[model samples]
Target: MGKKKVSALVLATTMVLLSACNVNMGGGDTASKPADAASKPAGSSSSAPQKVVFWHAMGGSNTKVVDQMVSDFNASQNKIQVEAVYQGSYDDLLSKLKTSMGSSDGPSIVQMYEIGSRFMIDSKTITPMQNFIDSEKWDVSQLEPNIAGYYTFGGKLYSMPFNTSNPILYYNKDLFKAAGLDPAKPPKTYEELKAAADAITKTGKATGANFAIYGWFIEQFFANQGSDYVNNGNGRTSQATESLVNNEAGVKTLAWWKDLIDTKAANNLGRKTDDSKKAFSAGQVGMILESTASLKGLVDSAAGKFEVGTGFLPKPADAKEGGVVVGGASLWMMNNKPNEEQKAAWEFIKFLTSPKEQAYWHINTGYFPITKKAYDEDSVKDNLKKFPQFQTAIDQLHQTKLNTATQGAVMGVFPEARQIVEGAIEEVLNNKKSPKDALDAAAKEITTKIQQYNKTVK
Candidate 1:
């Protein structure tokens, strides 16, 4: 690629304020297109585009892939520079955004998880993407149905969906064979899964299976059952105003989870996600309910030592698994910046969320592509055929519903609520509390939080 240039006009207005350091863009510029660099403003620069600081929480190989995308975007244009800074985990990024934005020292762009959507929506410090969409006349329909709803809030678009993933069932085929089960036939329902787990355990070949993030798993379960976990149309119509976790449907879901744990069909395995994964890799667990994003790590960790099979999460008896909610995170445009800076941020956001970039990101990060066009591409399909794990997630994607719960949950204190739910689940699993009691307590705690958040936001 030829050297891209940066516009002097953009450089004069844009400043990258990340960490405690200040990076200034000199008036002297290079001739580069806006698409070339991510961290820099896109007008035209002759020298290499100035870096636009991107605060992100992606780590491991996923981080490398994001950095590669930044590089790819940089090489494609000359007007702007994109600087991707690893900002620890999701919580770390949230902390940084909350603390730094008040001082105009936060990153221009940051990655926010799905759970953080409500928090961002409540914060007046974000530049809603709706304005940019209107200005650029970009097609929102180009995004994949399963993911598009996640970035939308109360009819306004605030973030760009980038890394999207869903929960899936990962089973060990060798364990299946030992239990006289067909490796090709994975469980389609909760009942079937229980039977499989029982048979696998009967052979005394492995420890019982486990699910990572039981709360997330349960949320998908409720969404599949057409049950709402909160009021206000599950927060799609209005912000969540009440708790639904203690309702009949939710009670049934919790009961089933309790039974799963009680029967030893699945272990509670508190959320050291990697430990549960390690158990699976060591052939100590026959089945694992893990995020689709963990597929890459599981595959690599197994290293051909076990036959791995991935499938959609099992459905409840009365309802088919409708749509697995999108997990992972998104990119938000920070407010408090000048109009020119916001425009430059919009350009970078557009480039990052483009179909081409989404496809590459999906392949590299093992997350689903956020655009249907990317998944429908010949290359993507061919790769899926070759890699069955990838195909399993794609199949699940097509079967999703776009309602609030399945589309994505929205609540002001979602992360806090999730932590509360996680603790309750742990208590129930450890036999310290009944499922009903545990969830009831969590529900009450979350409801108070929801009301508090509503009051605060209002």
Candidate 2:
């Protein structure tokens, strides 16, 4: 959703959706990952029913649910006939969206990945949701603030969250018990996590940990340490013009990540989180970091084999300030469409966020409901009773200190920046460069990309 050709030099491809699409499993890559669980709430349009085209990137079972929800919406009213089209993965959808920029045939509403927010806002092809929120006096208080915070920029909400998630620490309890370690005691800090990994490795039962070399995890680590990913309040207060990942927080994170693999306590699973997931489920690894949306799948995967334990994402022992940022994608209403079409899409959007729909979404898909009221639903309550692992994510989310760091960084070149960071991490982990050297070079490249992006968006 960029206006002009943006940075992708490091990626060697067009800016693909390396966004939090299920973060690939729930928000990772979106393809190899399980289907995204998302639900929308209700609103009504008294006007004549119009054809509202919704483009989404959901695949597998998640796609079926999204389609069913659309069917339900279509059946419930005649004011809006929504054609929910599956536009491949987030990567494919983004490519298609960019190509369809000048045409009026694009979707009235599109579900874009979270990291694409900055690009979407700069493209000026989408109408900011705040316009409708203010015009209708919608009480957005019903939405979760943490989820809402990621979509908010320049003091306005740019998109409506559809399927949202955050990362958590997943450990194999059976492995822990086998190693004679307390299964109840998952790691709380970097040092503790390392110790636990060492214990697990030393026991010869399983490897200690296997965290994917994901830039999102890197960003989360920075947030956990109360550090910024870029300048200007993580690009919330004003336009970001530089990279901040080469600082002390970044060096420490990369160094630790490399050390974990180097010391043989953790496995270097490369950038694919699914490999780590496989290792954890197979009892080859004790702990892994992944999206909360993976709860149901991880539980189901480890069933009959081991007990799965959920804990908050690990941070440095000294990290007392920052928290996690919401992963997953959101609904952006296109500005190219008519006001009525946009309004119809809003009705559908409202319906998706409704407490009833959200409950169904959470119960079936593992995505945390966007609305607080959804928790009150009996079905949601029942689902939680069945899978208490969700409580860990809930507790972690509530415990997070809302700040600029936790709000997450926004940059038009974010996708490229993430890829660049991964390249830097790989360089250090492969012993090609020192942590500071790799990061400094990556930061320089990201800064150049940011400057290019700022020029175009301005």
Candidate 3:
């Protein structure tokens, strides 16, 4: 649990062009060592440690956690040194990573969002984590199946799940009580949620609810309805050639969301998650749908103001009860690196996913640990006790069934498809078009993009 100061030198160098790897080291200036060198394995000796560059998209408080974890890993080992680099947002990281391919300076390990799984696989520039696991015969039974399910396809885990999260319903318990609703009995189905929202609005306790118009949430709704986002078994059994977001489930989900906005039960926050979070934390909204990763921020923002409560995301009453897809990023090892570098990167990944490190990560950040063993750790248990709301996310994830819909849609153009979905949502909320029409148009466009992507990958 010791925090280490991140070297400014690494940050300064990392900000340079993505294609550049040369770092200017003053005479006798080796990479800054951790303050506690005693943590290094005893009697372990090696030549110059193999350096691994890790490019990640984590920012704000999450970036601090990544730096601390990297420092801890570096301190605990003597044969490998990892330089963690902040590579802007997830989209920015993907762009830069694509352009840096085939260059000698590309990162040895990169963190990409879950939606980019198919693209990473098709790029053919990644050494699938499954390859390493299979070669070493690593026992991965302890890994969270629901989280691993998203990154796994064709019976292989292409990337290592890190910073995994799932969406949940976060509500202001004080606001619920003021609205004459039981804070302990949060809404479970769409009908219940609507009723609660209406009561909350009528009582003037809060603005009922609000959530960002994000495609991820739409996808979750589809999953909750047991519907696929794309054909070809949600793009798991084979390559996805088209998008299925225009189906009946998609139409129903969008109609419900539009009704909520039109009825003034929920505010249309557009695509700015921060705006929605701000509204909820300020007690202006009774409930909000957001990733579990927002727990820490929401709690801190509402501290001494209101009590926060969390529950599984609401599903349609008529739909079969289903769970959510994992959101967040995963770690992928870059291909074509030197054997030593590849092995070193894998070692760092293994260390990061270990029970102790995962527990520390889960406690510090709101992200769920990918390993089941992490929850059994004393540190994790203590943190869970302090904030029992965190356990709701675990329970929600545990209830998730391993199915095509829950595995999430996979396509080379998934990022673009998400943007299209968001655009369609805006159209519906703005009353420019009905849900079915908007979704149909979006599905058509996404299908074309997917077909084009398939051709290229083929």
Positional deviation of residue 329's Cα in model 1 after best superposition, in angstroms: 0.6
Q: lDDT, candidate 1, residue 279?
A: 90
Writing each residue's lDDT as its tens digit, candidate 2 over 46-162 gives 445578899998788888889888999899977679999998877778878876765776888898988888877766577778877886788999999888988988668889998
lDDT of 2: 0.82
- Candidate 2, position 211, lDDT: 86
Per-residue lDDT of model 3, residues 42-129, tens digit only: 2234567888899998888889999999999999978788999998777577768866766677898899888777767765677778
Worst 10 residues of 2 by lDDT: 25-34
**Ranking, lDDT, top scorer first:** 2, 3, 1
Clashes per model (N, Cα, C within 3 A): 33, 22, 0
lDDT to native, each model = 0.72, 0.82, 0.81
- Cα lDDT tens digits, model 1, 377-412, are 666766676566867887887777777767766777
For all predicted structures, in order, the TM-scores are 0.86, 0.90, 0.89
Candidate number with greatest lDDT:
2
Quote the positional error of residue 163 for candidate 2 in Å.
Answer: 0.9
Off by over 4 Å in 3: 1-46
The whole-model C-alpha lDDT of candidate 3 against the native structure comes to 0.81
